[model samples]
Target chain A: MTRVVLVPGALALLPEYASQVDPVAELRAAALAAVRWLGPEAAVLGDTQGERVAAALMGAAGVRRGGTAAYLVVGNGSAKRSEKAPGHLDERSFGFDAALGDALVAGDLSGVDWSLADELWASVDGLRRASPLVSGSAAVDYADDPYGVQYWVMRWGS
Target chain B: MTLRLGRHEFDDDRTLMMAIVNRTPDSFYDKGATWAEDKAFDRVAQVVDEGAEMVDIGGIKAAPGEEIDEVEEKRRVVDFVARIRAAYPSLVISVDTWRASVGDAVCEAGADVLNDAWGGADPALVDVAAKHDVALICTHTGGAVPRTRPYRVEYDDVVRSAIDDTVAYAERALAAGVARESLVIDPAHDFGKNTFHSLEITRRLGEMVATGWPVLVSLSNKDFVGESLDLPVGERLTGTLAATAVCALAGARIYRVHEVVETRQVVDMVNTIVGRRLPARAIRGLQ
Candidate 1:
């Protein structure tokens, strides 16, 4: 059976980037839980910074890199969802994130527009690469944009 | 090292703000604002609301004045310490006195620390602190007599003298049965030293901190800052906070100040800059 877990590539999730008060506490909790469910070892796919966040979550879950049937993908939706977002406001961010989120939950990305995704400041490189491996309904553990940056934690099993 | 200030225990990384609550009518900064009991109580409430961890209640001003006897000093501060203790059980109450008799009375009334501003003028003050199991602030006054201003005081090396004298006083307090963690050293800026001497002490404060003993700096609106910046008492806050930041960078554990909120902010910011403290709730670019 193939298992897949998705978490946001939030730099705040890294131990070195921690603050006295956690800013992404809820997202971190959901991400950690979903990542832990991915089991002992999983191949990680993400950008450089996303890889750091994935490594931190794996370390926290006490999972080492080894052969496994699980795959962990670090990516996130639009960062320009609102005026306060890191990329500032983009009117096209909401629709882009909605379609992207739907495609991710449905484990289908053949219809996703990469150009629109880039215009909305979405981090979906890893998601695009891993979409071929995800072929079942995803259990969405979390979905929010508390800091004007959309984040999601989802898991798919087959 | 963990600090045991009477009934309270603070972790090694924790820095404390000891707010000044004067019971004297002639204190330089406030100038009789909290001289009355009710006013002093209100001051305590204000400082506690402002997030001060401790209060240093002084009966007599540092400057020489009409003689305030031990009985008078105890009358001014001991009962007030008891009253504050009853109201705020967790607030660390420190009595600023060099008199053993007043120290004993205030400790009996629930004072947690004896801040000997005169640098162990009363030889038995340490014994009183040890008996009550309270923390003692071992200060360096350059051997000047209590209540007397510095008059052309010169030292071979002011920093060395400060370190030597304060460490010796801390050792004496330890020998007198005071807990090692309960001892804090202060350079006593502007207490018995000229402006230049105080400035040197502030510059070389890391040497005192390097003694492996927790250092407390009482540099709030002192003459050293005023002379350094040519500002009077009310205008010396900026200079004082500047001095405070330097001391915080040097690893001072406690700040004795007239302005608790400002001093706390400066110390915390400096500590964060030095990587000794994490940002309060940072998510600026990491999000």
Candidate 2:
């Protein structure tokens, strides 16, 4: 049996980028709670920046790196969810994120369009790589893109 | 170092706003605007509403005029200090005077800080502060007598003189049984110096901050700002806040200002730019 948790690669979650009034307080709390369920030791899978965010969250949540069974994956959906999003408004974002979010909750991401995810500025590298490890219905902890970017915090079984 | 201003304490990284509330009728700025006790009370209320962490209540105007004796000074600020203390328990009430007699009177009335604006003219003020266990603002006036204007004062190095004099006064206050955290230093801009001296002090304020004592800058609508911009009293606020930004960059801890909102904004903005303060609520790009 393996445990897996997924969090957004939001740079604001990093300690060094913190603001006096945290903009991502709820998201960070959800991500941290999800990461903690990955157990004492977990393997991180993400792109360069995503990995840095994962490391910071692990450090904050007291999660260590050793065993590979407990996987902490960092990724997110479209950045063009709205006009103010990082990638600006893209009508394709809603459909793309909907498919991706469904795939994540259903625990099957093999049919995701990597090219469309890249066009929408979605970070799916870790999610794509961790496809084989995720199974069964995921326990969705958080799902929203308040900043025009899509973010989800979900955990797969032990 | 943590700052203990009477019953209140602040972390070292926190900056403070000490709004000016004049009880004198002839003060250089806002002449007679808040001279009436009720009017002064209103001023205190206004600053508190505007988020002033402290209020520097001055009885006698800084400039020379008809002699305001110790009794008159006490009559002006003591009851007012008690009134403010009763109203805003958390507010740091600073009584600005160089007379230890009036200092003692106000301290008994619940004043928190003894702002010796004349740069320790009455040496016993520290003793009074010590007895009350309150904070004292040790200022540098180049040994100028209380309520006397600077007469063509010249310093080989104005910043050096300010640092040396203010630090010595702080040391004296520390030795007089005042808590080390309760002693603050001020460069006393335009108090006993010409525009040039004041400018030098403003430019090199970091040296004063380097003394490890919290620095209180009273730059609001002073002569130095007027001379720097050739602006009149009402127009000098811009120049004052500009100088305030410079001092904030150099890490001044307390700002004595007539305009609390504007000064607080300028200090917060400058400190954020200097990386000493985090953005109030930043989500510009990392969202």
Candidate 3:
């Protein structure tokens, strides 16, 4: 049997069943649907909301955060860069302050010590010079983009 | 303030954190977020507390500029770095800009390295780096990208071209005076490439190791990761870590990620596999 290189295309939100249901709730369902495609031995590491999708996966396989079957979370700040254009949030779009990002990321993790200023500030300090406000003007303007939220969660737990 | 400056040194081979500090108000996410020096310092302290190994500071932004006078740019850059250095004396700092004067100013103010987006745009910047013996990272920027291409410009071959261009730029920087050991290469993922181009380059970044210098893959939730999956900026964590892991497997020496703790974990895991390898095999009957 040929070894498959599984590269799940970017996670897609499910089509809205109706106007009443929350889109995020529907997205959670779609994410759960996508988890079925992963191989047993394969582990996942990427960004998403907190651990809802991963939690759902855990329910399916009967696992926990640090159990035999495990996944990780790396909550993101924004989803996409521009409004009209489409793309994943780049490092440059993580958040406003370290504290804000930490608060957001804290929602996704457990057992890790999270303070007010998680790591957003350091991330900001490192790249701000190369990617100054003047340069990132376009992205800033696109803040209203639905996918521009700067949170990412990677599922590693089973 | 206690600031230290060095490369991304890992602690117990876990993860190394290099926090980002933007002095410019025009930065993408928190545009005008750090317009005030106190606010910038507060952010810096937050990253340090959260666990960052080094801090990178920049006066100018990453996008193309309309040929501003080199002297004015240098003066503006050095002034801010000087202030930062004085205020936070113990922080390990890196200055981001391709101007020679800016490099000199930061070094004079005690910065440890010079991160050049244009990879020595003025060549004098190379001299500044040599004079201070500062570590360097070079990223390739397009002179201009055709508007017709919109975000998706053409690359002869994304991976090969990126590596070649980076190596060429590194060679030039080295020839001008920057030391090889102090040199690092960034493929300039978002400088001009469109979504597809960025993804192609990032996914196949291992090819960059052949360039013979440490590669720093700074793909912290970049645009390509979002577009590929139709994710909004807020929903890119899965994509970001996935991208980081891909580059790490490609032999990236340093990963400039925004999500520190998470990226740190992935880097630790990937580096374990990349750092260790069964020794090279004897050539075909040559040995």
Per-residue CA lDDT of model 2 for B87-166, tens digit only, reads 99999999898898898899899999999998989989899999999999999999998888999889989999999999
CAPRI-style class, candidate 2: high
CA shift of B90, model 2, Å: 0.4
| Candidate 1, B156-247: lDDT as tens digits | 99999999999999999999999999999999999889999999999999999999999999999999999989899899999999999999
Runs with alpha carbons beyond 4 Å of true place in candidate 3: A1-158, B1-15, B64-80, B83-90, B142-152, B273-287
All candidates: TM-score of chain A: 0.96, 0.98, 0.29
Top candidate on TM-score is: 1
TM-scores for all candidates: the values are 0.99, 0.98, 0.54
Task: Give the interface RMSD of each candidate.
Answer: 0.8, 0.8, 26.1
Chain B TM-score, one value per candidate, order as shown: 0.99, 0.98, 0.80
Error of 1 at A37 (Å): 0.7
Candidate order by decreasing DockQ: 1, 2, 3
User: By TM-score, is 1 or 2 better?
Assistant: 1
Least accurate 10 contiguous residues by lDDT in model 2 chain B: B278-287
The number of the candidate with the highest DockQ is 1
